[model samples]
Each structure stands twice: as C-alpha cells, then as structure tokens.
Target: MAIKFLFFPFTHMNKSQLKTVLAFFPACHYLSMNRDFKHDPSLQTLFETGKINPIFPLPEPLEKVEQNFGQYLAWARIHKGNKVNLKSLLKDSPYFTDDSDVTAITSQIKGEKSDKEDANADALTKEQSLLQDLLFLKMAHLCDEQNEGIDLALNDLIIGHDTLIASLRGCQSLVSHVKDKKTIARKDLGEMMPGQRIRAWARSLSAMGALEPQGGTPLFITTSEAVFGYLEASCKDLVNALDIHKIKVHENECENKNEWQHLFCTWLMRAVQGDGIRENDMPVVDDRCSLLGQVKLALFSGNGINKIFNCSDKQIPVCLIKLK
Candidate 1:
C-alpha cells in the first residue's frame, strides 16, 4: 500500500494574493464565507438562475477586454472609411490579418466616398430648387403689397369700430353698476378698468391724426366720412354684408343748438344699443310698437342707431343720463 500525504499550507497573505484566491472561487463560496457578498440577494438569485447572462465569458482581464473593444472600433472605422489613423491601429492588433485585408477595407472606403459625393450632388440640386421657390415667394409678396393698400384701409375702419364699441360697452357697464339698487355709486364705478384702457388707446389714434375732438365734448370722435371711408376701403366685406337700405345716419336731428344737444344725447342712447353694448347685470333695452309714444320717441329720438361710429380723439365722455 502506498502512503499518500495531503500537503495543506495556511500562510499569511497580502490583500492582492487574498483577492486572487477569492477570484478563483465560485461567487457562492464567497457568500457562504461572508467574505465578499456586496451584490443584492435578488441579483445573486438571478445570477444563479442565469436569467441575465453576462455579455462575455468570465475570467476576462479588464485591459484585454478594453483592447478587444478598441480593435472592434478600428475595424468599424476601416469598414466605413471614417478618418482615422489606420496604420497606428493595425500596429499591435492581431485581428486585422494581412495586407489583403487592409486592401479590401480601402476598396470599401473608396466606394463609400463615391456614394457620399453622389449624395452631396443630389443635396445641392434640392437646395437650388428650394432657393428658386423662396425667390418666387419674395417677388409675389411685393406684388401683393402693391395691390392690397385698400385692404389695410378697410382693416383700420373695422379696428376703429371695434374700439368705439369697446368704449361704449365700458360706459354701459359703469352706468349699469351705478343704476343697480344694491350697488354703491361713486365707490364702485370711480376708477378705470381694462375696458377703460382700451378707451385710452383711442388717444394714441387721435395723436396720429386718425381721430379728432368734438368742439364742446372732451371725447375725441371720428367723423362719419372717416369711418365710412375706412369701412369702404378696408372693410368692404362688412359693408357688403349689411343691407344697404338698412343704413341710416341720424345727424339730421340736430335742428339748432338745444335740439341738436337733445338729438346728440338721443343718438348716443341709440348708438349704444346698436353697438351691442350691454352690462351683464343691466336690463335689456325694450322695443315698442311703432304707434306707441315711447316707441315713436325712441325711433325719432334715434334710440337704436346701428351704423358704426368712432371718436376723432381720445376724450372721455361724461354720462349725463341714467337710463333705466
């Protein structure tokens, strides 16, 4: 019988030597010993189950793995003919076999160059076509501008009408609040609102000479001619939309001075209604039969004037009457 002796040696080891020994063992051995189990239990379970496999085989040296990746990148660059130092890359890499392999890579690179040149030529042609289209658009814009001056005038008229309507609405709201039985007079309606801001903007138009001030009144008003001209010039669509027979100017009510004053007040009441001016809390203006005295008064008094009107200047109109 041959005697067999098993030589077991336990020696004091440095950190690196201990690490090498640990690296040689299976991961489970380290977990059992409580030596190197930094990974999560779930991850260890997955590793044990092989659900998530490693990209490469283990025992791979980090440097060699990095070098292998560099070789792959070099090969990719050569295959694509991307600008790179091919000679330096081939210096130490063994994967690139021989001169013939390099020659094949160069041939592929030349073909890619030809393809790129063709693509660039096609791009140039498309760019030139786009440039021509842009030039045509520029010329067309010039022609459109020359032909559309009257359109701008009509737009101005519409804008003026909108401004006047907005101002009238503001006045209506202020007056409505004052008339409300629960509302306090000077306290609530004392200051300006956003509507008043719109009204203030009329002053800018007056400064531009687009509007003028009435002689006795502070409200800068636009003339009927100016309003009509703007409407005819810029807002032909609006004018065309209205029935011509329905159009009426109530200026004839001003007989002398006092009658004219009454007529103006009456016209204002009518204009306010026509302008779609309303306060949310206020009662709607009533319509009476033509034979009724109040109805006749309203008609003759110009209570429902509908034609668009504007101030010539930025002047605030004072409210003299509280219409119920």
Candidate 2:
C-alpha cells in the first residue's frame, strides 16, 4: 500500500512552514496567470510602492523553497494587498504527503501520548483541537487588518464552509450522537441570523462575487452541522442496506464511546490534511462500529441530507473521495 500523507496542523508548522504555506496564495495569482507578473502594470506598481522587487525564483529543493516562500509571504500583503488564501489552499493541500512515509501523524497524536504525558496535562486534547480551529479562524482575524483582508477572510470562510459541506455529504454516516441538523431554505436563511459568527458568514456569502445584494452567492450558511434529521428518520433502512448489523458494535457498552466532538475533530483533521481517510483509521466508536463508517452510510442512504438540501442546491458535491 502507498504511504499516507501527514497533515501538519498549523500548530505543528514552524514559522517558516506557516509562512511558506501562506505564500501559496499570492503565488497563485502570479503563477496561474499567463502574463509575466514581473512586467505587469499592477504588479510593478505594487513592487515599487512596497519597495520590493519580487522574485519568482522558487527553489528546487523543498526545504529551500519553504524558506524562500516564507520570506516572500512576509511581504506579500504589503505588496499585493490580498489576505493569505489559506482556506482554499488548505482545501487543496491540507496535509504534507510523502508516499514512502507510513506513519499517520494526526492519528498518532490521538493514539498515545508521550511517556511523560499525564492524563491531566493541560487538557492537551482540547487545546490541540482548538489550535486547528484557531488557525482556520485566524484568517478572519488577520483579514481585519485591511479592507482587502476583510474580503479575503470572507472568501476563506465561505470556501471553508463549502469544503466542509463537501466532506460531510460525501462521507455521510450519521452517528447516534450527531444531532439532527438542517439548513432551511435559502430565502428563510435570514430569519435565523444575527449571531456574530453566522451573521458574518452570511455577509461573506452575500459578498461572494458581484457586490449587488441580489447578485451575491446563493449559498448562505447558518449552522455547521449537516445531518438534517437523516439518521433518526432513516436509520432502519440504512442499517439494513449497509449490512451494518454485522459490524455495528453497541456503543453503550464501549469503554471510550465516541462523541460528536471526537468524530468531528477526526473528520476535520482529515479534511485539513487533504487526505482520503483510511477506512480503518476513521474515528473509532468501538472495535466494530467506526464513526466515519456510520456517517458515510447515513449519507449514502436514500431520503438523506444530500437528497434534501443538496439535490436542489448541489453547490458542493463530495469531500472525502480520494481514499488511499
């Protein structure tokens, strides 16, 4: 079997790797465009204004490239005025992959603590989870620095929302613990807003392409959960179809029964790493019944969430496909 890619959470990245990761965005604008950015009118103006004659000499060695990009990213904002396009880049390359490396680094973080780690040490698990969330959220905070940052933050959050939607629907397996969640009609989406985060998310959606109120992106995100009562309403048909009876271990009797939070964290971790989760390594509720397996089953079953909201909207088709 080929080796799995190790997703280094932003916390795991040193300053150099973090900035190098951020640099991918500005590099996108230049690299993907046909015109040489060096002689472009807007780029030249930026270089002159920022007093930075940007160079496109990305190093051949990954290590040197990391260092060079880190340096360039430090000034990318001063020159191009775009916020770090981390959300989309992360969606594309969430984890570091080496075909020869067999270790599952994120899995290891939850697998076993160091010999010195105490069970009570700093609530290490929670802290670790928050670090990932904070890193994704930092895009919002960082964008507050400039109007351009605001737009970037919004784009990041919008794209992040789309990415997660793809993952959930693609990997739909409804755990008993995942509450039945639903997204209302797009027109009705406004009634539930006003909470700071949701409002901000809605605003981002509104601002997506053309600035006109009606011309904005049709998607409006209200809550993060996507189950939408699919599990409770259809568990019987689903259990029989997947032949879940064969492997469905009773969670009530399990020692460390998985919760929504655990499954969620595991899912997000996999998404950030940009990896197809090994069927075996998905969040474990018990030896027989995997949290991810159940979710995927629930998603695939008929009369599911994908059928409900996504049938008409269908903005994000799938998120967890490239299973290696």
Candidate 3:
C-alpha cells in the first residue's frame, strides 16, 4: 500500500492543549549514560543563559527521566477522556489560572462539525484504563528505592484513576483563608507547572496566527516557586522567541491524531529501514530511542485502535479523510 493515507475521524486538540502537549514533552536532556549522568554539552550554555539551578537528583540519565515522563504523559493525553481540556479542568482550582487564548483551541478540540465528528467514547475509556496501568508502573519505578513492592501497591490504589490527578493533596488554609495551598508535597506541587505551561503554550500557539502581537509578550505566567521554575523558564524562553505565525497546521495532519500519526509513521519507517532499530530492543535512530513508544501510542489513539502496530509493518493503512 506504500502507506496511501490515514483516516482520522476525530476532534483536534485546541492550541492551548496542543501547546501544553508540546511543552509537556522534554526538550534535549542528554545527560551521559554513565552512573554520574552528566549533562549535555549544550546544557552548560543553557544553564548559564537561563541561570539555571536544578533541584532534582541526577541519578538516572535525563533522557531516561524524560522518556519516563513524556511517554507516559503522551499516552495519557492520547487516551484521556473528554479531550484533555486544561481550561475547564483547572478552571475551579485555586492553584491554576486559565488562559484566554485557549477558547479557540478548546473549540477546535470539540471540532467544527459536531454532527460529523464525535470521538470514540468507549475507546477513549479503554485507553484511559490502560493509562492507569502505565501510571502504576511509573509510580512503582519512582518509588522503587523506598520499597520493592510499591508498583503492586500503587496498582491497587491507583484503582481507576488514570493519572495521579485525584490522589494529590495540598493544604489549602482553613485557618489562613489562603486562596492557594502552600503546603503541597514537592512532587504534588510540581504538577501545577505542567498545567500552567499547557495554557501558556496554547496562548502562544494562538498568537501564531497573528502577524505581530508585539514583542515581550508574556509566554507563561504562574505562581509556581523556584523548584518547578527550571523547566518553566526554558519553556517560556523558547515560546517567547518563537514566531508561531511561521508554523503551519496541515489539513491531513489537521487533527492532533492525524498529525501525530503522520509523525509516527515517518519515525517508524526510518527505524525499520535503518539498522538503528531492533526487534526486541528499543528503537533508537541516532541515539533517540525514547520517542518510539510515544509515536506508536499516538497512532493507536488517533485511530482508536487498541493494538500496538508492528514497527516492521511496511504498509500500514494510514488513510486521511477529505482534507479540510
């Protein structure tokens, strides 16, 4: 079939959600594979330019951490129910603020023709369930140092929750009347950063359509402290410098699924053709194996197919609906 086209009859993610999705993925975290896990050569300049002071431990290579974080997140977002609405999801939370730019993006996720395109609810539910399983595995890995059985325990506690979205707790003041809780655990508190970044990216993506919106435009704003500040600073710097007007959202790659599917196909094809990939081993083209699972998962969600596609499949039928 030479990969004729991929049909994606699904709602597209809005700009804010899409941008958040982008920002959620780690950039270039190339710490050495040795036990020391040294930073990438480029990171020295980035640290100096950004004046970075990181608080997280450097036990594992950053690529591993990023792989763990980004892949699970990408999968969760793909399989999340109700289209991963950062605006409405965080609207009532005191810790987060909704960006105005996400309005258009939200509208897009719902799709222009509701009668023509409604998402696969049952399939989404199934994906969310699987995401919970992945979450359990990740949580176990994170807590492996504390206890060997954490994964099994986490599986039971995670129960039906997809992400740790519900189990998290922060001490909102009953006595102090504080609007946002300050006593949140370091790990739990860190979750707010991604939420803020998601909206910020959406706003920036929205501005991409505008020819000029004035320089020094705020890329992202949040009350998150210095701990989560490291990643956010880089995110803001990148978006702040970007001219989104230059970016194009292709019609076939029009929806998030189709776009992701197209990208995944390109990646998988390269891996299959190149000696860089292996059957049982992780696929690493030019030493970047972490992204393979994410691409595959994206394709699965785009088409609501539960089965993982074989990397060696030469002509996977990825059809496109009539271009918008």
Candidate 4:
C-alpha cells in the first residue's frame, strides 16, 4: 500500500515530503496567491500601518505545521478581508476541482475498480477530518498566545463571536500544563482530576453564554487524548450513577462487553445530586441547571511500526499532546 502521501500527524515527514503533500488544493491556494508576497503594495502598506504581520522564511526546515499555516492565514487576511471569504478559505480551497479529476485521483489512490464508491466516501471523510484538524490547530495556536494573539480576533470576525477569547482565559492554566510538557500523560491526569479542571471548563462555557449569548455551546478542544481517555474511563461510573445509558455512546447497540465506548459529552457532569461541603466555606458550583457541554478531542495516529506520542525511553514519560 502506498501510504507515503497520507502524512499522519506529520512529525517525521521531511521538508521535501511536506512540500510534495502541500502541492494539492487547500494548501496550494496560499502558496500560489502569496508568491513573493513582499512585493504586494497593499500588503506592504498593511505591514507599515501595523495591520498584517507574519513570520516569513518560516523557521528553516519548517518542521512544525503551524509555522507554515500561520503564514497562510496572514496572506489570506491581507488579501481577503471579508469574513465569508476568509472562512471559505479556511475550510476549502478557493480554486475548485472538477468531479472527473477528483474521481480519477481517488481511483488512483485506492487502486481498485470495485472499491471506487467506498474509496470516494473514505476520501471525502478523510479530507473533512483533515480540515477539522487544521481548524483546531489554528484555534489552539490562538489559545496558546492568549493576550498577545490576534488570530482569535480574526477568527471572531469569521465566526461572529469573541467567546473563544474569553474561553481561552478560563482554560489558560490547563493549556499551559500541556504546553509545558508538549504531550499528555498520567501527571496531566492528576492535575486535571484533582483540580476539577473539567468543571472549570464547563463553567467557562456557562460564563461565555451568559456574557455573550450565541447559537450553540462552544467546544473546549484539546490535543490531549489522555484527558479524553480519563473522561472516557469514567463513563461507566457516570452511567451507573446518573442511570443514563445514552451518556456513554457505545460502538454497537447490542450488549457487547468489549465494544469500544466514548463519552457523548467530554464535559464532566456532577453524577451526584448536591455540591460537596467545604471545610473553609469555599465557593461551589451551582448545579441547578445543566451547563452547556461540548469538547472535541484530536489525537495522533501512527502506523504500528512508527512510535508516536511518546519518547524512546520506557520510564521517563513525556507529554505528547501535540497538534497535527
């Protein structure tokens, strides 16, 4: 199987390999539009006026995906100022591909006539998933920069809300934990559970809604699968305590003992009825109503032959909660 072009999490891919992969639609859009961007008088004016600023000659070898992606957004913002245009560029390639060409590419990749229909479906799913990952990474970059970032402000223009900025403030501590380690691990779990980090995130959502009412609950996205796994493991206890089978969505409807299970909501709900008493009369979460709950967990995947999300040493565990 020819898997070279797939680029899973992409930590190992060299510069030439990345350049080869990015020669396609979505990535190519910026590279084509911003050819010699320094020559553009309008963009140069924006730079002079303290409007658009992007790190050019992006960190030689360009190993980190965000370094290049940040540059892409910078070019797009300078050229396309409209929210509609920016969001479209963020989600899809401005240059359109015809159906015949797309079909041919899909057929070549899958290399089987009988699997043509399945291949098309799978390819679309993977493409959409990739776009989603990109979106999350961009947001994570904004969250990391917090007070110093303008990407979230630009995103507010696209999404029509400043909730992400406020929400970032609430989860800044948790974000820092991952940033310090560069991955998720058992210690991260310790910090999350004992500190009631999940509850804090839920409260952040609640505050966002109260401060600026919006259509839906904004998700607290993270690259920490360890955090997700901790919540997933608690699904059984939450199921028993809350007496809601639907709380944990199983892979199958039948009573399969070994079926994979995941939480419907990554937010932690108080399984018990009342707030715990405090020794020193500390503040407690008012749990009269359900807090708006949502979270998206992005994870890294590598072939069994390739080690991922961990160091070569067996004992000294390092953080692996990285953006793909």
Q: Assess the local accuracy of residue 97 in candidate 3 as a C-alpha lDDT between 0 and 100.
A: 21
Order of candidate numbers by TM-score, starting with the best? 4, 3, 2, 1
Candidate 2 structure, TM-score to reference? 0.17
Tens-digit lDDT track of model 2 for 94-160: 3423211111222222233343344434655533332322322223223322433444456556656
Candidate 3 lDDT: 0.28
- Give the TM-scores of the predictions, in the order they appear: 0.15, 0.17, 0.17, 0.21
Candidate 2: 10-residue stretch with minimal lDDT: 24-33
Checking candidate 3 for backbone clashes, the offending pairs are 5-318, 5-319, 6-318, 6-319, 6-320, 7-319, 14-105, 16-202, 20-198
* Model 3 worst lDDT window (10 residues): 4-13
Local distance difference test, per candidate? 0.28, 0.29, 0.28, 0.29
Off by over 4 Å in 2: 1-201, 204-255, 258-260, 287-324
> Number of backbone collisions per candidate, in order?
15, 10, 9, 4
- Tens digits of per-residue lDDT for model 1, 124-243: 553333222222222222333333444445555655565567567877564544433222111111121212222222322233233333322222111112222322333323211111
Clash total of candidate 3: 9
lDDT per residue, candidate 3, 191-256, as tens digits? 423433322222222223211223311112222233123343433111111111111222212335
Q: For residues 1-324, could you state the per-residue lDDT of candidate 4 as single tens digits?
A: 101111222111222222222221011111111223465565455446543332221232223334445544566467565887656654687342432232232332233343554566556653333332333333333333342234435533533333345456786655444433312111222222321333322222222232121332212223334555545443322212221111122111223312211111112211121233222232122333222222232222222111222212221111112212
Candidate 1: what lDDT? 0.28
